[model samples]
Target: MSSLTVLVIDDEPNLVRSIQFSLNDQNIGLHAAYSGNEGIKTFTTLAPDVVLLDLGLPDQSGLDVLAQLKALSPDTPVIMISAHGDTRTAVKAVKEGALDYITKPFDIDELELLIKRCGEQQRLSKELRFLRSKQIHTQRIIGNSHNIQQLREMIEQIGNSAAKTILISGQSGTGKALIARSLHDIRFNDAPFIEINCAALPEQLIEAELFGAERGAYTGSVQKRDGLISLADNGTLFLDEIGEMPLAIQAKLLTFLENRVYRSIGGGKERKANVVVIAATNKDLKEAVDAGAFRADLYYRLNVVPISAPALSDRTSDIALLVNFFSEQFAKQEGCKPPIWSDDVISQLKTYPWPGNIRELKNLVERITILYPGQTAMPKHLPNEYKQNPASSRTEDSNYSSVVENKERELILSALSQCGGRKGLAAEQLGISRHALKRRIQRLHIDL
Candidate 1:
């Protein structure tokens, strides 16, 4: 919450004074240095949040000073200020790790905006580093089972390889998206990892969303849009529920995958995007292809580096670790002490068939953490379904089936209400598809 400090390194006294006066009432602390040496010394001592260095300095070359500053603190964001004609020097500074560069006589408002953006970037970078460090300490793939170990080894091998197109197949809630993210973060941490759920968007909008649109491409188009493909250039694009993508869009995506080129919805020029595509789906692509629901060519292309995320039921040995991880995570979020998981609770959890996989376990842990923080969790603390035998619980008791059906109905209704009756949003919240939700509604005979 402290005011962000900015260090300016420039020789022009008038310019420095003007900058200082301009930012005096802006709630930002400004420090000025007239030469490169003074700037480096002040930078080392003060450790400002952002630095504005002039490409032309009095004592030493600004590039050298920038290099030294980066060597000292690589995380600090440094913006270069140069004369209008010194574009070459600005480019050089940027190549040498400068965050960005601005020409002289820049608008004060624009400079302030740039400084704020730099500060936000610094904050996000710090948070990402913290998360990465924590992940290193705590395995992202948390399981000691042989299948899990082999899966982890495969992930590492694929991550280290140069495979661009990857296909991740698993059941719903088995952490396919997590595996996709892990693959992206492991290889390209500095780039964006954009995710798009194919089933979440309607057929009318998915194409525009993927390939972008011009101002007049559609009814609501008021401005030109850069789609996920363009935005994910030089990064990774995760296509979730890839089997649900419309057949028409599948062809376009296939073309893009083949050539890395795509055209906007209503544009003439072809745009290029150098991106890695990681597609995931719970449905079997082979089945979809055989049924003519998915393109065979696209499936072959994306299956270059296939990886399967194991279901939680298959990796029951990791139940305790995952429980602790989720419990501690939820406890931190709720500002409470983490719960102690008794052996009985772990055994109970290990026995339950997690139909929703890791996601279900995480939700259960969060629910328990919120309801019984700082207490020891035993088998009795679990939900009734988990406490009962899996097979007999569903088949033997009519009341139990009724209770589950009522719960399902309530969940569907709640999701629909929360989404303002938007079927796509409701389906996403319920972790199902719009078509599936329609079928459920018809089967339940729920009145809208």
Candidate 2:
């Protein structure tokens, strides 16, 4: 592979020379520009993979230059350099689209790591853009509920740092992948998101899949291919269902996590992998560790920062929003009018134990939209399991009984009013016959 190029922008000639020399010693090509204007011109001409931008320039501010460069090439990653007291300025640069910011007189090692991360992020962003363009509909994390609000706050804090390892734990369908993707999009949208389901992979081939095989590492290895870890170098490798990773492989993973290095299967050379690993699992890894099924050391290595995806039950308030979101999404894909859901439908959705979480709810919405046309989703529109199980109707507040009764009464009134007070017509509109409507009305002792 060719050596990566880094462009350094600073008014101080001494700082520029030092950065250039240090980077060159590492065999990375370095270019320098003395002012923001020159830096933008050089950046445009050289198209360096990463830019170390000094926030203060003689002619123009670094933030202005960053804004211009971003406009020119949105995918390019910029790292702002600031003086000791200019931390606020550096932060403003980040908000203006810089990849990250570093303090003036930054450690050589830290600058190198930042440059490397920028390159990785750039590569990943290209891949994600491609994936997004191909996808039919992408689900976004949307909510102002306390749970969602807290998660967003944490994600913002995490994204501001260069932390590499993150563990996202939650029950199945609780949107672990969504959170992982959010993190990737926030910091490393410039890199390819390589996702692998550990639970789905065969244990025998898992190692080779992760670390790459050397054209004959084992049976069926016809070509030398880069492993996910290698492919995600400077990018994110999202390991879903990571708890299912075999114990033997966990040891190898730990080695890579510890040293940021790995040897390909059947290869003699040990290569450094600068990938950011984000592992997610539905199972309780602590319990697994206690049972001797999971390695505690590996768990700790991956859990540098732990994030929990809130379950559906934990954030029921978001269900109505989610349902509307998914309903419109499916409707657009299917080329139909977006379906609406009555409050009763939403109420039932909020009450059901979403064992499958957001994913399950999304699937249900899709199924309902596809199967029922020109109709709002109601209790009858739900699947048999949700409909038949009255136990699913329990809400946190038992006063929900009044809510259900109100819904029932509203439906009856709407049916009668829509049918112009004709019992037979109202019953038919309500999807029941006149006899059933009469019985329900009598049982509830409704005036109308």
Candidate 3:
């Protein structure tokens, strides 16, 4: 990765040069300006990843500079540097939007760690903001089937009410998360909608990531930080795949849901958040609870307003609507004109039982857009799986090899199709070597 561009604004040349040398050796880019006016001017041009502003400057006070820089780019992370290490100064700087306060005699290693942590946090926050804005501006539930209608109605009612917890359950790729986002949108304000995948992180990290951790709370936790729940105060926190959460974390989450109060991993004053937590999963919680994989009490608490997402096969009538919508969407995304779908193609799609549901359909359309943008989508343009008799795609057969081979073939074909017939790119996308991809292609008798 490229180094972080850090702007250092201080009148003291010795400290500025020392930091520049120290960070440069660590592959962190640094820029310096001695006066406040010069610092602000340089900042406008550099737009660095982080700013280190000294409390005392030659031309103006650092507080005035901090205010201007914030007004210019409010999301930029700024750390206040001062000789006075008083708690009052630290609190005032933080209250005025500085990320942290560092005394003049700060350790270089400590500063580096702080810079990395704060920089990474702001980057993640900015990315989430971009994605949320894009979603808010362009995407929504597209189908109008009875199932989708009921979902919209549920979202409307939930949005209008004061429901704090919602449980969305459905098969994989059936847009359970989308439904969560829908619920968020209905009651949308300036509050954030934070999402964390329970299965994505290790058990040890999930608690800290959720409720937060103090300095020295865990290995590598160099600085105190706010968790997703805290960041999402007065907003929404979408817990994706909550069924996969660790048993211990599940217990803690249940407690928080019960009373809105939680303690950090290292233990501090009890904190409270007023965010709506929407948990979604593809698993049957009742079965999980019965099997002892999920807590019964937690399951009951989450299932208060249970919503079941409909599979694509259950709403065959909406196939065409979804396909066309996905086509136009991927087209605009890939910067190509939308492909035209024939009536016969639509009929064939409606016949298939989409095990992966809406997600599979969406991925296929995106592949088509990349492969044959602006062209009419004909039956021949369909993947081999789509061309097969929909009845044969059923999983009722006990032949394990046949099912695995079919799925493998579809996966390879989709990768190749998405990469425009480039073996290297396809292999990369499949997380396999080019040689491996060749062997599979030959073994599977893939014509491509």
Candidate 4:
């Protein structure tokens, strides 16, 4: 802690020397400035942890320097010093964002104590920021349904094995990444887990980026580069959308898997990369193999362990848990009060067929929070597609017209109820964004 830096500004040379002598060995490096101009220059250059500013400076007022420093780095604590004591002046300093102020004849020990307090507060603020960012990825599978429980057990079983390859099959937005992270956290929490979206990467640069290239290996290769695979050595590598990998690259990757070694483009040396591979895909890889797209040999290698993630529609009972989790998460992120999900709204959420799975659910919660603001979520707050559509929830019935009349009546009633009998608000709520809500009420023949 002795390496911590403190910048001191004072017009008096004797006072500056006295402070340096008093605090030299107290876990802080001292920097001195005699004028406001010099103080600003030093503060910008040194980026000190704390600043001790004198209110009276030769070139400019200390308040001016304090304001400038606060604007530059709001987190650095600034303590003001002044000889003339006035309530108004102290209040003004505080308003200008000064952390604290001390008189000219202050004791050395008192000044040191103030500085230490500021340091502790700064450290706490940094830690809080880190924890907030960390929680976004620290979550586990938040469900209690039988399907999810079975999936968890299978994940644990595969995680304890020594198989170097694993494959995860699921539809888009089915929490594939969550399952992958769970497997990694179970086995290699201490080691790095690198992830790459194979579909998002361009085919040309995928090879060089995966396997490192030597200096002068290609036209733009000015320095030797270590690829993501090298970084994942002795760890796990997750390749998402593996079916999108180009055929040429697939052939090279197959070779690399057979012999734990790969040659970079325009380089002759074979680099050894020992990494456990976990690949995920929404496409049917077996169909791709049958069509001569994905290599059959690579498919067998990746099939050492296989796990399938169930779609959200197959497990509607988990919607409430997911909604609550997302609502709390979004509320924290937005810094706004979390909205309440009324029982009616929750029932409506359960009735909808979630085509996009968990991702879609998260998106809907965020949108609901935005529209409802500080109020509770209601049926009228939902978008047009999910407004009391009984037909949409029919899992076995293929007859659409049989349920249309009941759905339309329920939707109009819900809209009117939420809009307080005002047809305009009801119409807008129903996404009929046309004529007045009264006109909609008359058209739907609603009594309200």
Computed on alpha carbons, the lDDT of every model, listed in order, comes to 0.82, 0.79, 0.80, 0.76
Estimate, for each residue in 84-133, the C-alpha lDDT of model 1 and write its tens digit.
99998887686567877899889999898778767755654454445445
Clash-forming residue pairs, model 3: none
What TM-score would every model get versus the actual structure?
A: 0.59, 0.57, 0.58, 0.57
lDDT at 297 for candidate 3?
Answer: 98
Off by over 4 Å in 2: 1-139, 392-448
**Residue pairs that clash (backbone atoms under 3 angstroms), model 4:** 423-437, 424-437
The Cα error of candidate 4 at residue 81, in Å, is 51
Which of 3 and 4 is the better model by TM-score? 3
Q: What is the lDDT for 81 in model 1?
A: 96
Q: Model 4, range 195-269, lDDT digits (tens) per residue?
A: 999999898778878887888887799998888888888888899999999989888888888877888777787
Candidate 1 least-lDDT 10 residues:
129-138
- Backbone atom clashes (below 3 Å) for every candidate: 0, 8, 0, 2
- Write model 2 residue lDDT over 372-401, tens digit each, in one string: 422546688675556646475433444534
Q: Pull out the clashing pairs in model 2.
A: 121-190, 123-191, 124-190, 124-191, 124-192, 125-189, 125-190, 125-191
- Which of the two candidates, 1 or 4, achieves a greater lDDT against the reference? 1
Q: Native-vs-model 4 lDDT?
A: 0.76
Q: For candidate 3, what is the TM-score?
A: 0.58
